[model samples]
Target: MPVLRQITTCTEPSTVVIERRVRTRDRSVDYRLEVCRRHRWLASNWTGRRSAEGSGGRCGTVMDYRPYAQIVQSHADLWLRPLAANGPEDHDGDLAAALRAGFEFLTAHREPTGVAIALEHAARITEAIAAGALPLVEGQAQVLAALSAAETLDAGARGA
Candidate 1:
């Protein structure tokens, strides 16, 4: 194993490796593991510069270790759905529900990035509603009140 180490762990658990180098007793055994999709292979075929004289230990130099990181990213890509290009119907309760779901999802999923995403979604939905999306009725005061509350919450959060 080489004393220098590099570790990369992605949000999607995948690849991992440990490396080290040693010099002693006129000989040393350097060990390393390269893993990908349950595949394991030895890289012991390396032992020095292609045309160096005297003696030198292999595994002390850096090499292309990207294959390991690529494995981890492969798993992360599977976890998220691609946003649709056409998006939801421009004028339907279904569109409201979908927009509401996105706002809800953004709030419930508290990432370090914060809940700013939810506020943006909320604003977009409100804008759509104001543009004669779902016709407002005199008796829709209840709905408007609820929307006001949600807006106030989002505004307070932004100020905080």
Candidate 2:
């Protein structure tokens, strides 16, 4: 069995630290989960506090992770379905909104890995648009505008 411990501080209401230790055949391993309030980002570490750098920075009020995760997942699903089906005309607004959310997330987090993934996805989406693989529908100029904004932001972030 593993032991779990939690630590909280009133001064930093947005942060919660959870520690768990499990005994293995050879030794014991410790894991830590840190929840940040404002960004609602989850940071997990196998070793100690030094490894929590992945969780953005220290700011904002903490919120529940489940709801945030669900919202993000739902947005991602909604945005991806149209691309997967090559049905952008059916989901122009949705794709635009999703791209905006994704850009915000990347800007806030600034994680190298996540930024890399976003850049890749953006490139692919742009290529698809340019190739006419994804067509726009009525009143979907917002989609083009959103894509352009996201691409510009990404380029600036990358110092390109």
Candidate 3:
């Protein structure tokens, strides 16, 4: 099983929880950590310290794009999913998972020799399966063919 580095979650009441899991028991290590709104973060948002183009904010150049992409993705997902998810009542949950699966499957299979999962890749994996074909990570050409077949059925659907 994959061990989570930390689970940073925010709830309806707007509380952000950051918990780090300890793999083994050790006197120096603590397993349970809880923080609330009273918790303090010593972050200084210095507006004057930034470069002309704001290079300081781009500290992790390559990795910085994801959080921004995720922000947009989450917003888009909320708006777009209702159409796809509200299909035949029985298939509702599956609909959401399949859409997510489609993107996960795509990142698992990319064009280059090295695999890189782009946060901005809005590939409708679940939607593809929702439309009827499975996304096989064999190659790009085959994947496109499968996607086309998926779109055809999706267009024929009465609801989503």
Best by TM-score: 1
> Which tens-of-lDDT digit does each residue in 1-160 have in candidate 2?
1222122221233354443445556434344445456323333312233334444423321221222233223224433332233223344644434443444444565653443355345545655665677763312233333333433344344432
| TM-score of candidate 3 versus the correct structure, residues matched by position | 0.18
On TM-score, the stronger of 2 and 3 is 2
Question: lDDT tens digits, residues 1-160, model 1?
Answer: 1122111111222232333335656335343433222211212332332222221322222222223223212211211112111113332424344444545555565662223343334346455656766544421332333333433344345431
The whole-model C-alpha lDDT of candidate 2 against the native structure comes to 0.37
Model 2: residues with Cα > 4 Å off, grouped in runs: 1-97, 100-104, 107-138
TM-score of each: 0.24, 0.22, 0.18
lDDT tens digits, residue span 11-53, model 3 = 2121222222334533222212222232212011111122123
Q: Which stretches of model 3 miss by more than 4 angstroms?
A: 1-138
Clash pairs of candidate 2? 37-61, 37-62
In order of listing, the candidates' clash counts read: 5, 2, 3
* lDDT of each candidate versus the true structure: 0.32, 0.37, 0.28
Where does candidate 3 have its weakest 10-residue lDDT segment?
A: 42-51
Candidate order (TM-score):
1, 2, 3
Cα TM-score of candidate 1: 0.24
Model 1 lDDT at residue 10: 12
